[model samples]
Target chain A: MPRTNRQWSLARTPRGRLTTDDLALVESPIPQIGPNEILVRNTWLSIDPSIRIRLSSTTPLGYLPPIRPGEPLVGLALGTVIDTRNPDFAVGDLVSHIFGFRDYAVIGTRADTIGGYGLPTRIDTRGMPPQWYLGPLGSSGLTAYAALTEVLQLRQEDTVWVSAAAGGVGAIAAQIAKLRGATVLGSAGRADKVEFLRQELGIAAFDYHDPTLHESLAELAPDGIDAYFDNVGGDHLAAAMDNLRPRGRIAVCGAVSGYDGAPHSGNPDLFQIVSKELRIQGFRAGSYNHLEGSMRQEVGGYLTAGDMVYHETIFDDLTQAPTALLAMLAGKTIGKTLCRLTSE
Target chain B: MPRTNRQWSLARTPRGRLTTDDLALVESPIPQIGPNEILVRNTWLSIDPSIRIRLSSTTPLGYLPPIRPGEPLVGLALGTVIDTRNPDFAVGDLVSHIFGFRDYAVIGTRADTIGGYGLPTRIDTRGMPPQWYLGPLGSSGLTAYAALTEVLQLRQEDTVWVSAAAGGVGAIAAQIAKLRGATVLGSAGRADKVEFLRQELGIAAFDYHDPTLHESLAELAPDGIDAYFDNVGGDHLAAAMDNLRPRGRIAVCGAVSGYDGAPHSGNPDLFQIVSKELRIQGFRAGSYNHLEGSMRQEVGGYLTAGDMVYHETIFDDLTQAPTALLAMLAGKTIGKTLCRLTSE
Candidate 1:
């Protein structure tokens, strides 16, 4: 074999809606493996809302450089190594990387480092699906763990209200809070998600498309809410402010509602925060890099003991990647949406 | 001499504006003092914005009960004892009690107690004006202290931004932060207040009526702010969110901006909180009742050493009480406003 490769590159800057034509699939010479480099045959790719932020000139994160046009779109993916020069990784082993949107990736030991480390390892998936690495057992899992347990210091007996409860991060967070013995309540867009949260996840209460969400929450937790895990910002955050009890805590994780539109203009009733004596904090999972070991241990144990459950919406082929991404952005997909690049 | 007593009672509830006619002064027969009661001649009464909340049925604090149609309006006051049946208090002793807006009060031994004990022997005026006991060394002072030092855990080297810098709590909070070696910047309403904060209080920087407050704050704090003491909570809060550094802390103390009007609507850019990893907390002075001894000690020492300064616009008599309160609510007063009932 002459070592063939295929990669997708950004074709142009997107103004409003991005189309498949905006990404160009190109045939390129396979990269040569250097000392401390590993060549991976990409198997799966994760599409997230954070990618939309990277696509534009504005990022609320305010730290990373803006993505330029005519460059490769960078994101997370799972792959198996076909060739390796790095001593830490074997040729037959699997790995995850901050890989570009490509069919194959050549990852160096020092390349794609963020918060001062390379990508995570791909341990035995056992009988579990490989796509689980992109959902609950991966970045989304770490995000839920860090925000709930570390940043918010969630108590087992506390009442938790989560927004976007059907999305990847929100779904896992609600389950984790329930597993921790919390009274969990979640909000989603459709009736199916509401039923999923109530019947499948054993959530204490669930609401969908309720215009009186604030009043509904008040009625549900008449004694008042102890903590809120916010994924959808804007109106949801404002409602959380009103429903929070004295000394309530909020962990701000994501803001999918306003990501594609003009920023929300109304100021929250901050007076409630003052009079009720609440605490609101923001967190990113990347900041908790050291906790990866503990998180993996705990979450892995939970999965093995049947205390945790997860769902995934899989797109069969790489050609459907654009549709999957669009569905995820529109919040039409349930749980974690993944694009399967190759058959097992 | 025959004993005579005069009491002021609420005659009617004002629809929009309150006047002296709303309160009626009537002479009453002096009742016999009970076994656990002490009769005191009201000397000084402290009027505050919190009193306004108690006047309405929809108060958020839920502390004082709503005033009855024809009952005496009660508040925090300083007085002198003329007769005592309680063993803990003696005649001729000066005391602070939760009974005011009247000429005399039959304070129960259980009612006039401080720290579960009877009132202290004497108040130390210490070259500072006696009115300060109602402003800086009083409940308002404790509120600012508790929120900034305890709840917010403000650092000595932190850059602090304060809103309503010329008002009672804000003026004292700004000075306190400066004393703790923090770089203090503040926002007030008028040019005179800006000058007062800069020249009189020695604040590092200040702005008045700046249409571009957000831009001005960004320029002042190029590195970003470490902590904020929020008093005026609408746009000021949004501006603070934009300028906060990572891991920044905000102590929400009051929301005078939205106090009298309908609650302001709209989703503020709370996503900034998540991206910056900020911590925002609300605090009440009552929560830190354990710190009363230490807080008074420190504030009293500062006053005695001439390190802290305060101002009060005094209304001459009980008839002018409503006007003084309206002045404070309208932002007409420079600092704390109180009503003096007697020369003694």
Candidate 2:
């Protein structure tokens, strides 16, 4: 086993736009495990936009505190147990936890969870891609499922719009809603992503940048949308409000537009909430972790039938993790963005 | 019966800050009632903020069409049916209908309802003040009751904030929540209204104009509020988001700040909705008219037992309906604002 561990750490809080110098790859001796502890060698890292909220010096109230400079960045990861002192885990066991951006993690039975999820649970890959635990059959899948079923209460008669359709959660949400027989419309920031949504996912897709967003949406749904899966906030949210029917619903999964260094525009005409009698609910998948089993069952069925398209933009090795995050944040990556670490 | 009827009409859509000239008190002949119709002499006019939305040249999509110049304004009014050609009504029957801003109204069996509420219905006043059917025992009361019970789903353990607490809906909402055993905080625009909220309504009260809204709210609810009843939107909503706890809820009843000709501020930090896992719902009381029976039962019990204080800012005669609306909009009036028309 390697004696040294390489981990990504925040060098400084990012300003308007993130730069390479803002992050550092730090080296240290592998952390020793105590009784009831398991040492994991991470094989995959999930690069999510929400972590950007912690890279700043301040976070929104009630959210996790900011990740200070020189501190290791924490996220969802899939790893193998290399050394185990806990009876529940054995060497070679594949597990998922909330200690990522690193080569190795020393986990205890009481490891921290992200909003009640990612509790260092064992994963049985059953010969399928083990990395799938960190993607579609995991948190991303559950997020989409919970938002659609619980928050938006999506119905078959509903015409729903999924924003940021090229991203991790949006892609699954758009496909799942369509699979449930709802008329779905998807929006992405780039032409290629839009094409992927139309051809690969087979949904009505649009580039949010084309003309005005409201006009693009109006051209597609003149009668107005019944529900919205919002992955991007700001203008996207405003546009969704402009096009939603009376008694419309919105499930806010992420706000990628505001998480970056860009200044908040605060442009949404919230009065739409009153006029249209709209319902807007913001949620984190971790809050609904109980739905994970049902999520895996359905998503796994789609994968086995080859009816679902699970795409990934993977960065090679630990050194590329920062680049992967930047690419995802700039809307340059499609589907789930991840870092593949070569386990020795 | 009087041969002439005086009605309030829109002379021109107000540009910014409505003035007396924007509305005109015009004279018209009282129309003869036909079969299935009733001629009512109006006694009370309910001056509400939502009417300002229709006075503009354009309204929010999905809302009722704007009232044009020379068109008579419509609102909820209490009147006595002096002449009836319909079997469902009789002479001297006290009733409530959407035909205010006039001294006399000819109501058809197919009279319009507001958002599915406000249908012309007979009121048994039962020896109570007949005008209470226009104030606490009517639409304003129903609005507050529906917002608290249905929209907010208020709990006894919750600490909720009601904005515009001295106004028609706010006053009732604040008291109803307080009477239900929830810790309530009330906010009003003026110092006198603040005093009324504290001394009369018997709740923790603050002037929204004092210090900063966030500071004032934080001072009272340092731990954080669980639900918010939003009557004045814009900055008030921003403050609520800043001070709400995780899983917080907001019921959007009105946006008095936006309804006037003033430019919208659009200053609320919507990202709070995501990070804090907030739930926001906008509704009109008309949608929950089914709950009106239960609402009147509980609210009426409060009134009979001297547990509720119903305040009214009354203006004599139909000529002051415009002034009453302006006063309510400017936050110059307390509780329910009404125009007491002297019926001939």
Candidate 3:
């Protein structure tokens, strides 16, 4: 058992692009578990793009507040309960919580669940891989499910476009949309990712960097798409608006194009929204935690039936978590970006 | 009556700012009504902002096609039937149709209703001012009513903000929203229009030019607004997004800011939409023609009970239709902009 805990903390608010020097991995004495508190040895951390928003000097309105310098970064992680004063949780139980980017976390029963990274919950992996909970059977899966079902109300006959279709939530969205029989067109920044979406995911895909985004989208969906699953904003969102059919629906899950110190491309011809009577809705995963059980059931079934393709770009240990995030944001990672803290 | 019919035609596709030189009123012989056709001597013409979009070389997708040079312009008009070859219509009957910017119209049975401008329908004015059919009781009224009821689903607890609040649709939307028991705030560009909204319309109003739009909106609605009725897009839309509370709703009726030659102001922090979980729906009055009866019942009741304030900026004679459009687009008009062609 480790006697000390090492956690990643923000050394400064990043100005443009983030760097390793901006993050500090500091070792400290393991925290003591108080009454009703649980000590968790975090084994896996989920590296997501939304955290980049919090690293700025001020986060967007209604979002989680910015993480100040020297504050440990918070994220979703899977851990084993090493010690527990809480009656409900037992030692050796694998749990999921929002105290990640660290080797150990001290959790309380009454921890805040504002972003739906709720209190630690025990996972019943059901003989499946435990890391799957951090990917398709967890927040990523729920985001895709809620967006397609609740927001988009995707119909089988509809043709839908998914931007950044090689990313975590988007990949799941593309597959689930196809499983429900919608014609899916996926777009990615890189040629390799576009190939993956075409050959591996079996979805009509395009490289957004080729020619013009409008022309690329036009080629894939000559009749215009019925719905759009937006993971990249800026030019991608503008293209979707231009190519969407009348009365089209758009589900905005993320706007990663502007997350890495780049200004969001504006002038999206908002008149398109009025002219086409388009409906745009922006959502986050925390709001859809209610659908987690059903997501796990359906997605887990897909995994068991070999009908789903789950991919991961995982770093070896906690020290590489920052590298994993930079790689993912740079569009180098293939699928869900994860940091494996232990070989357990 | 008159043997010659004076009709407004597009002289050229507008380059930037629309000028009187862009429009030419040409006199032509009145056409005879054919079988299943009715001849209407237009009495009042509604000069709306949407016409500016048609004057451009190309319109937004799903919108009415652009009117080319030498083509007569079209709009909503109130007229009296002078001759009828159809059994359903009788001479001297009052009618409303989409054949404005002209002194006379020959309406056929199969006229397209793509934008919900159906074939000519006789309007029973019920002793109300017949011109009211073009203002509070017509397309403008229906637009406000549908936005509040259908898209916003306005609640009594909602604090709603209406942009371009002194314009035809915005004024109606602001009043209707207030009548539905919601706290309403209005914004206009000019001081007099702001005064009209505040003192005459009895709503909390602000001048968008005073201070920054965000500061002005924040001064009016400090906590946050629950709903936004957007008529002028660009900065107003961005401000609303910035000031909307979580789960806020925005009903986009028009984007007049972009309809003119000026480019739409962009870089609205779209992340705010996701953080606040905002739902934005763009709609047109044509889509909500079904609610006309209910709108007439409610708004007509308000006007009859002396609880509604209806104002008009009238341009005399058919020649002033171009001036009326320019004034309306430049925010020089208060309430509905109209061209009164006849004394009757």
Worst 10 residues of 2 chain A by lDDT: A110-119
Can you give the DockQ of every candidate in the order shown?
0.52, 0.82, 0.76
Question: TM-score of chain A for candidate 2?
Answer: 0.98
Stretches of candidate 1 off by over 4 Å are A1-39, A61-65, A81-93, A106-133, A262-267, B1-38, B61-74, B84-87, B106-131, B261-267
TM-score, predicted candidate 2 vs. hidden true structure? 0.98
Report the lDDT of model 2 for residue B278: 98
Q: lDDT by residue for model 1 over A15-130, one digit each (tens)?
A: 66566776667678888989988888888888777676566656664444456677777677888888888888888787877774777888886635554326647557876667
Among incorrect, acceptable, medium and high, the docking class of model 3 is medium
What is the per-residue lDDT of model 3 for residues B1-344, given as tens digits with 9 covering 90 to 100? 67899899999989988999999999999998899999999999999999999999988889989999999999999999999998999999999999999999999999574666869879999989998998899999999999999999999999999999999989998999888899999999999999999998999999988988889878888999999998888888998999999999999888898887988884467777788889989999888888999999999999999888999999999989999999999999999999999643
Q: How well does candidate 1 score on lDDT at residue B171?
A: 85
Query: For model 2, how does the per-residue alpha-carbon lDDT over B253-321 read when each residue is reduced to its tens digit?
Result: 988988888876548788888889999999988888898889889989999899999999999989889
DockQ of 1: 0.52
lDDT of 3 at A207: 85
**Model 2 vs truth, CA RMSD:** 1.4
Better-scoring candidate (DockQ), 2 or 3:
2
lDDT of each: 0.75, 0.90, 0.90
Which residue pairs collide, candidate 3? none
Better of 1 and 3 by lDDT: 3
